[model samples]
Target: MWELRHRGAAARPGGEAASPPREGEAAGGDHETESTSDKETDIDDRYGDLDSRTDSDIPEIPPSLDRTPEILKKALSGLSSRWKNWWIRGILTLTMISLFFLIIYMGSFMLMLLVLSIQVKCFHEIITIGYRVYHSYDLPWFRTLSWYFLLCVNYFFYGETVADYFATFVQREEQLQFLIRYHRFISFALYLAGFCMFVLSLVKKHYRLQFYMFAWTHVTLLITVTQSHLVIQNLFEGMIWFLVPISSVICNDITAYIFGFFFGRTPLIKLSPKKTWEGFIGGFFSTVIFGFIAAYVLSKYQYFVCPVEYRSDVNSFVTECEPSELFQLQSYSLPPFLKAVLRRETVSMYPFQIHSIALSTFASLIGPFGGFFASGFKRAFKIKDFANTIPGHGGIMDRFDCQYLMATFVHVYITSFIRGPNPSKVLQQLLVLQPEQQLNIYKTLKTHLTEKGILQPTLKV
Candidate 1:
């Protein structure tokens, strides 16, 4: 029976063999005494019929589309299961790299579109799961209400983005100007409309399910959409902000898998059985080095180092700026041990890359807990993956489970530690105000400047 189970586990692609008995549990040993014989017989009685069944009694499982390739099938049949997984993962990695380069070449706008696209897909996967679970409950307009809420939220966020970043163009259109003027009021109205519709659609028996799904959708929005907005904010700071943290997570994920595949033995956590301590530690060092190197390479490019600024004269997002201290190379004193071993007194490094070490460490440590959280969610729902959007990587949510957490961390880190006053954004906001409001701000600024002696009192009036 044990041999049959082992053979079945080996035949499967993921190598989920049953765990062996611990050190003292061998058959016919002193451990199985007469006193325990009755208990053992009761266990056998419960499942003894299964041992009599032949292999023919079990139905053969059909092949999936993924296993249709003859070469892959033969390799899986011949090579080690780990090797087969490596081959598939390697191909997927290459494909992802190709897509990444293509998007990067297309520039920041394309990357924004890609992010928005992923957000929509992730939202779809999550909402679909909700629908599938509650479909039988026969709730009225559940999916519609969820989508309406999504639209309302997106309208509010995107409307804010346009008003803040595209102030010049917005002033040109009377309709947009009016909308921007009453943006907050209009957004609130839209949300209220959706809320009313949901309340009206609530059926008597399905009220509990409807409310549960409502909360689920909102929580999903908070988790996926809100974090994605932060990611877009990171992108506006510089593509590097969006890229480095994301890349660091991806690097950590890949390196962890690689290390774990070859070296992992002891399980790291109950939530994810495949995770191991060896992988976590190995991935940490590798991600740190990779993050530093990537940050260094990106700092040299103006396209990455400069923030995304709108130029009214050119009517486009422009990248042009003197490199900030974060990107500039600065010397740091080395430790005494390093100074003695043919090392220089100081090492020149980009301050941004130094920060990348913190980001990478978070990605390696705390970021994965986000994935584990998703894993627990899936287990509770009895699903394998979120959605098979990526052939090997599961859903966008699955792939970006860590990235979302990393994105929020990067955004907060920048806002708290790195970001300075964005005179342009502030100026844009000021421009969006009414003429009277603008005048008040102008007077306030003038008065402040005069008090500071930057503006002469005689020239003011």
Candidate 2:
């Protein structure tokens, strides 16, 4: 070690000196004093006490890796150059941005797969971290199973399916039949998958067995986001579905981080110690602006870039779908290629789901809560970033936490409020019912509505 640097010193410097070198002493006699430089070199090369050993027999030297200052060091040593730090961070940011846009460009319907991927990875990190902080334990295989199952049957209670299956169900003569028929298999599948996950978690012994079961909520949230995205994708153009939520949520996240970095002063929540109240409020409002921007853009070009995926217009041909219809749907876990060809002609497509603007906004306002919630959980466990996978950014959980909850909320909202607008009675009244049947039903409703002609947008029959 330290001895390696001297190269033995013909090379030996500091030996013993009497007074000064005696007259006629070997020229090397003074070498021992010169040995201070050798000692310095040894200290530099082998991480020794050179700062203290100024007179030691070692060569003068540069600082070693351990001696390089930290971020605040201010000095620029080859051992800790700012350029290397900046270069690494820049490359990492570039990589994440590239990935973000790659998913963006892949049409929305298709990107459900990506959403699913993020959900699984992000949730896996969250759940595993809980175990790490609580018991310093690693639960590997069970976590993998949780992710796999979460991805597989997420749409059980949801009626998600390939585009065409969903389209054909809605476009056919029977509307009520469409919903009832699809839910039969899906409901069972949903419960069955849930049961399986429950059993698996118990049998495999993921840490905090009961809590692991509770973590199913994470799985549920993940599923919900996937289904929500599918609906939005189907209702609007695939692009908007991808663009709206992603732009709103991720943009807000970035904005918050940036604002917090520069302008943050007041603390928002103890859960997020570094989170600034200013940043939070700034981010929340900024998200609304982004939502408006998204809506405006999607609504503007929807006609050209997006064609309707479906419509209630009863035409056999496809038209763009609405958010309500798209979100409530639960499709089979059919592979894309198979489903694509099978559902091609039968399904509808849309230029954009303008209704999603409302839905996306709902997702936005509620979105910050998702981040807050995850932050709370992390702080409760006293864990830092989920992992160091992303250089400047935190782990997948850090990135997608908001989207998971926001997407779930939006999906649920669309299913209830936006999609199920009881248009079927209105549709039936306007269609080819038998004259007698039509007359009877019309007569019954006519008196009521006629009395209440206040309904300016009267039934069209």
Candidate 3:
């Protein structure tokens, strides 16, 4: 009879005992089968015994609306969220408006201080970001060098402004006179010192990052300090230069948001996905119209139209000028549609308003590109906004990005078209010259005038 052996095989014909056949013997396949079955059992146990489950045991997820329209969803999305924070936004807006008027009432000096403050804040924000990125590498003197460069740049720019606008006052102060006299040389030496320090502090592996940050600091200074200086230049030209272009941008932003929220359909630019073509077009038209009206109203006030001239006699600022032709009303032929509607031959408008069209056109069309540039910079850096300084308004940089560009345009416009030589400034320079130098300039001027045929009649020794 044949029998299954548990631990040993039957003895061979020689009657010798067979070993236990190395434990598994004839049951090796069965042991492996049991092990696989145990593993399956363990898996089922861990998974809550799936073999015993039924269709009814599965829970159903609630049905959701898969067919919701994107436009409707977008419109609906912000309504609830914005209303939830409406109080904060409202308070912020009121505060901003109040602060804006307060600055206006405070005059050009305060406005200048505000511009400087904002410039410093912007510089701080950008430099801080660079520091955070590069400081981890323990690069030596990176932050110090950045701030040093800022100081050097500000010293140069502000020194020039002081010397230009407050020449009499600066010449009175011995230290100020010295600084003003050698301002460029002083600025260059300071910057060179910082540059040498940067080179000396460079580490073996951090040279590339160090140079990158060096370039970054200079660029930031150019964008923030230089542009802010231009804004101050606008301030000096007149508060209107500061106020109107800024108002245009603010108006465009408000109207654009309102238009976009209600009727924005097509995307305007990929850099700013939320920007829409409808809003852009609406804002442009609205800004142009607003610029014309603001120009009209402001033209009527010497306070708005005249330059901010410092009165050393009274130690105060003054704005007193006969309205220039630029601010005077001129007759404009009405377009056919307007003539038909109004039954008038012409309309009276300030001549500067024509220039406003250019300003407004820039504020509407090209100005937003500044914001777009800022948006790209932020995206590249993976930042949401420059900072959270102004509550709902992101940061000072965020608010002033387009203003800087507008400032540049206004400055260029004034220099190119509106500016004329100031007799007071010319006389100040003449008074500062040596006696011989002054006499030479007079003789040169007299000779040149004598050469002109028109001046020959009036020529006298």
Candidate 4:
């Protein structure tokens, strides 16, 4: 059954085998065709037996608390798949949006936890796919090693985050200080242990398949854990940096679906057959506008614009800082063409709102490629969805494939353009240094500043 499924998946959509017989092999084509037909008959008989099995043999879809309400289900029972899917997606989209807002209101810590949870779920979903496809469940220590690697990777990332952002808190705790000081080395050691375990557990017959799953586990970790770490990093920069990009992706997804549902005429891509040019175009404009407005509104609140910081005194994370120039309103003279339309010569806008254009544009334009890549992956595996975690959304990974891509872009954008040398981060590092080393660094900085005329030189007296 597994071989048949894999063979079908390997075949091209054009009804050609993945590897056709060579020209030189034409003499044996008749024999090959006869053998292939015999194999097909055997496959058919096996499939018949499989389908004849009792319902109990089939796995049930995992129950979700957020399944469609029965009343709405009845009302939509008569609708076609297209219309029914539209309603399901729309309703669940709003529900997820509401949950997102609630998490935002709860603050950055909650947001980080949420990201971590999503990362784990995505990792699980992908690893589960590997297990199902390769039948690797019987492999010794494979599951254990996969989870061990996940822990090692997460420990490395979150440890760095704590060391960078919670230096003061770490300083207060001697245990945490030691962990933070050698975090990378510890992380590497942990991973090495897992690696040794994997080597030891390798079976002679399954060596190639075991290595494939090992690569699969690492790739999944790279996608889910590494990208999620970046998302949290963006959040720490400022809630606006995180929220705007994410919300833009969500907006584009919804607006695109709505437009495509109503006006789709031209197909956008082969991987995602349902995507259309109308949706793509409509989504772009809607996302940009939505991002602009969201940036403007979020900029008004210092809480949204301030970088998140860990306060040892307060014993919790805090978002409190002087708003940066990015958030500050600045006046710009309108172009001659637009002056008449706006009936004004100048307009006041937050610079971040201008940056939102790039974010929204990437979210709408390049972001869909992430989804396309995921779709291709699913097609390769002959799966409809990753899992039925969300009633309409398939899995956490399905909804977040584009989000991971967007988070990466946002992190790059901040580092490349917006972020400067952070004095606080430097100070945090300095605080971890020995007293004599800190004094030397302070003296060096003071001397440099004095030479530069930024600080007055003191007399030896």
Best by lDDT: 4
Q: What is the lDDT of candidate 4?
A: 0.85
By lDDT, the better pick of 2 and 4 is 4
Name the runs in model 4 displaced over 4 angstroms: 1-71
Distance (Å) between predicted and true CA of 99, model 1? 0.6
Model 4, backbone clash pairs (residues 3+ apart or across chains), number:
0
Could you estimate the TM-score for every candidate? 0.81, 0.51, 0.78, 0.84
- How accurate locally, in lDDT, is each candidate? 0.81, 0.53, 0.77, 0.85
lDDT of 4 at 281: 100
Per-residue lDDT, model 4, residue 164, is 87
Q: Write the per-residue lDDT of candidate 4 for residues 1-461, one digit (tens) a residue.
A: 33543465354234444344457766367456646755555544433343244424534333335466688789889999778877888888888899999998998899999999999999998998777664523666777889999999999999988888988788989898788878889999998999999999875444665787899999999899999999999989999999999999989998998899899999999999999999999999999999999999999998899998888888888888889899899999999989989899999999999999999999999999999999998877777778778777788888998999999999999999999988888998898889999999989999999999998889896
Segments of candidate 2 deviating more than 4 angstroms: 1-99, 130-152, 155-159, 162-242, 303-366, 412-461
RMSD of each: 17.8, 23.2, 18.8, 11.9
How should the candidates be ordered by lDDT, best one leading? 4, 1, 3, 2
- The per-candidate count of clashes, in order, stands at 0, 42, 0, 0
Model 2, global lDDT: 0.53
Model 1 stretches astray by more than 4 angstroms: 1-81, 433-461
Can you give the lDDT of residue 416 in candidate 1?
A: 94
Q: How would you encode candidate 1's per-residue C-alpha lDDT over 101-164 as one tens digit per residue? A: 8998888888888888888888998898878765644567888988888888888888888887
Which segments of candidate 3 are over 4 A away from where they belong? 1-79, 85-87, 443-461
* Total backbone clashes of candidate 3, pairs 3 or more residues apart or in separate chains: 0
| Top TM-score prediction, candidate number | 4
